[model samples]
Target chain A: MITSAAPALSRVHDVTEEVFAAIREVRDATVAALAPERPLVADLAALRPLLWSRLTTGPLAALIAGIGFIAAPGLLADAPWYLEWWQQHPSGQPRQLLRDLDPASSAFYDYTHWEWFTGPRVGRERTICGPYVDYLCTDEYSLTLSVPVTVGGAFAGAAAADVFVRNFEAAVAPALRELPKPAFLINAEGRVVASNSARWLSGSVYRGGLAVTPVPGLDLSLVQGPAAE
Target chain B: MVSSGARLAVFSPVDSTARVEAVVRRLADAIVLGLLTDGEQLPSEAELAARLGVSTVTLREALMALRQRGLVETRRGRGGGSFVRVPPDSGLEGRLRGLTVAELRDVSDHYAAIAGAAARLAAGRSLPSDLAPLRRSLDEMAGCPSPRLDGRFHIEVAAASQSARLTQEEIRLQADIGPLLWLSRDTPEGQDEMAKQHQAIVEAIERGDGDQARLVAERHVLDATDHLIELRLRLQD
Candidate 1:
């Protein structure tokens, strides 16, 4: 019986090698198809969809799915309140609104009278208030409150507002600070009005390249202020 | 005679298959260690079976076992037969995932030490060319608009050190720490602090200040470890 079965087993072994070879070819081709320029992380991302399919359709799929559910509890356990707030106010252009608000001074700005006005646009929440002492009120977006009021809330409302603003400022300040300040401005003439060190170092033409030349006889000084004249 | 043949067939013992499996394993090890060259044709089944003092069937079984190990391939047509094939190290991800937190911590320690050393070395060397890529990585990182890219920038920095072993180890470390980093990426405070730390490391590397680089890199990893611990505690609560 052993003799007879030995021959059959050998044949099975041969077949197994063939299948393995085919699998190897497939793997090589798949790896090669992922071009060298594609990063390892990108490769992982691409593999994830394939893996997901395998996990869903293969024998171990159920076990993996169960593990996924188990692992998800840690992720789903705590939803950050700030994230929720951000989502609710998606259009919350906090950076644009707080661009001029002094970080050190803004911490003390009063939020007691400040009301969080939900924007009509998705994901936007704006704080609204009437003008107060040391406050600059231009437009709704330009209403800069003093630092004292921000930290000077009477009760929990002030504390909550302070926390909310702090979170908002922290979220946006880094981005605004990193943005390259505009270097050169072309007035009416083709001459460069102003150039930042970055612009000078990089050598960028601000006014006229070949298309629309700078307007003739325009004042370059007018572009100096925060607002263009 | 017919009754006896039926009984023998029904109760046939295939225990010799274990011997075939053993041969397959040896061959696989040889292939993996580069003892066998890729595309090298293996001995014929008859030859192997004769060599092993087994029937051709058992030899075939051994070959099949090798195939399962990704060490060999077979062709069915004439002049087509078994050949050696090199398998990719696909087990890397699984191996990385299997690492315990303690193992990961060890890796983190090694990473910190090596990175600190590299920064110090680069600083002492003071070769502008050596520092160029580090600066470039930092610039790219600073320009990145998303937190995901920000995390990737650090990983890229580790990889750009030009040490394959270090890169591989760092990749494993990244996998171990990835989920936690992903969780923290959305937090404003977390993101800001992380970006600042990353910038500090880059600046130090650029300035050829090894001590600063070492301090920054070590602090970054330690801070991340602390954050993860804090997060775990929060979750426990």
Candidate 2:
């Protein structure tokens, strides 16, 4: 037992020493890699532009641009028309959306919209449609639709609105199904007649337009409202 | 392209010295930007000397300057060479304060959501192999009984999620939040609550209850946030 313990103790010491030495080696190597004589900076500088060019001018760029052009109308369709119109409007107040909508609700809507828009959709053919009855406000309504409206630019818009709505519903179905709350139905008037879970939305006044609640602790003022026309 | 006399002048020690300084500056910038990470061995001194077309002495001098900056450390032995130092945790307070309240809240919220998801996932999906290390971490936490250990416990869970980006972001955030957490750890209640939460999180993960795991992990982060907030408010008072 004594003889066994002696070797074990020595082995433990040896292991400890090895570990410390390894740590020292790692530290020294890290320090040397940081030496002033190293050519990493020049190499990285040369590499950066190559990466940037590849990202900006290569297939990746074209792919992104193609996707954007294809998806822009539908993606932008749900965006508040007043905001969209306002951007083109010579005398539009950018703050009108904020004024018309509750700041928190609008912000929440914007956040959720951003989340929903950026999220994956189920189909390429599904058109993007919005201005669906705003769950927040029953009296208010807005809609935007993006279809492959043009063979070139305007031709894709030839798809009927109902088709776009179907695609939008299809695209949004998975997320809606995953939602912990039951699907709430709103009529064209924008009233939430029934919902599965009503804790957050119940008793909250939803004007006919979509009402968005601000994320907790986020300041609504910093958020940009839809463009003013 | 230079005249013989001009070329001679350019090759003089003064010009050579200036060239060395420029090279050194470029190298320093690279290290700062993490083009070179800690523990990566440098090229041999002779190789570097030849590449730069400078005398070995000049290269040595540039290396020495870097050594003084605490960026590089040297070892002398048969197989020994220079290596980079682990950057010390510096400017931690300024970094924490640099975060906007909104940004901090967003990060906290994101951490909460993701950590919750990870806990739930770990509980529901963790294999027999996964439980051992997690159990080991719990054992270590129980043994160490330190706030630093507690922080490491949470960070380990984030790392266990197996997302490199998430792990890196968690480390950065942990570094930023280090001082505040350190200060909070001095309080008995803070220490006890943190430990309890950590144990609960581990248990939740063990049980394979995702919702419970998520809730526990989220509550743990929020508890830390609440403690930090209270500490800040107290200091102001």
Candidate 3:
């Protein structure tokens, strides 16, 4: 699989690397903001201007729908769970997303259990969380690329960015189309992120074990296969 | 225009095989729902095709179907393109009258399955804020039979379920036959009945009762199906 699909896999690798690089900037800034002292909840406010600025002017601006820091449980002095997330509105202004962190609330956003948080906490260098419908954020099918935020060798939280699958498809579909065979990008869970052929729809899990070339350094694979009938 | 949910369906990309039929159905449903109003000019074929991810040839086929159905008209030359022409009866009654009992039952059954499952999952998965959109839809339903709000209400439930596949299915179903299914909302009594049922489903979800939410959601769909069947019978009579 690697030998036959190396070029296509490289394209997928390049695009995924571009996305991770952007997310790492947020993660690096987060780690820096928390490094000097035992973190105060107010300290995260420094990330606000940075997030807003980057989301608006960054190279991945159009691809990323939201960007921010998601703190580890009890990492901040006053807040046990917090997400300093901001999503771009259709009007071009970005808005901060507020979710119930209270465990008692039925609407509580228990993001800690999500892959984006859990993967990094468990020591994965980077993670791609979903092709799931992000009802909580953009309400589009989204992929959350995240990196672990660490301070002094201790886990803190994750800095993540959201990319709507449609925009993602637009970005990489041309690349996938360049391949000689049907190809798709899948998260580690075998869920299809995007596909050049309609036979593999986004959000559908691909069960076939075909020629798979894993995108280096990310929990994603570029699989080449025949379209299912 | 349609609500956010239906708008997603309206502009969503379509695959090659289903391109013509999908485009026709989406535009037809939009017209029936009054999302596209009478005499309103549609975007050019090229633009519409691009947004829909289909070729201009396929879009022309869809436009021809809409013209045949009396839902759109095309004029050539300057200031000439396709324009919406909502049918006199708003196309709902006639379309309903056109259905056979079995077809109506099949579609209604399929909808109930989807709505029931979505409601059940939402009961377990939805955050408190997710209820806001559903509540707003109910509040809007109080005034009139706004199919847009009603369609949005169901789609929002699917969204609450946190499954994009379910959400997409709900949106497609709404665009396909939602106006017909929700035709009962046209009457004041029907409007109140629909709103109450929708509210019941929400309350069950709030209570975190998946079975109860599923029950209410399914019954709501089945009851609407019955009303549709009854109306269809009357049209036959």
lDDT of each: 0.38, 0.41, 0.77
Candidate 3 clashing pairs, residues 3+ apart or interchain: A107-B127, A107-B128
What are the per-model numbers of colliding residue pairs? 20, 45, 2
lDDT of 2 by residue, B98-132 (tens): 45555657666776776776576556544433455
- Could you tell me the TM-score of candidate 1? 0.28
Q: Indicate the residue-level lDDT of B214 in model 2.
A: 85
Candidate 3 achieves a global lDDT of 0.77
Give the C-alpha miss distance for residue A5 in model 2, angstroms.
Answer: 52
lDDT of 1 by residue, B117-194 (tens): 544543433233334444554565456434234444554455334233444555455544544443434476776787
* Weakest ten-residue segment in model 1 chain B by summed lDDT: B1-10
Q: Kindly list the per-residue Cα lDDT of model 2 for residues A1-229, writing each as its tens digit.
A: 1111223223223422332332233223323332333223222222222222222342222211101111222222222211111010111111001111222212212222321122212222322222232222111122222222222222211111111122223333443333334333332223222233443121111333323322122111011112221
User: What residue runs in model 3 are displaced by over 4 Å at the alpha carbon?
Assistant: A1-4, A226-229, B1-237
Error of 1 at B120 (Å): 2.9
What TM-score does each of the candidates earn? 0.28, 0.32, 0.54
Residue range A41-105, candidate 1, lDDT tens digits? 22322322232332234332221111000000111122101000000012211110111122121
Residue A103 lDDT in model 3?
39
Task: Give a tens-digit lDDT track for model 3, residues B20-132.
Answer: 88788768877776678999999988877655545788889989988998989999999999999987866777687667889989999999999999999888765544676
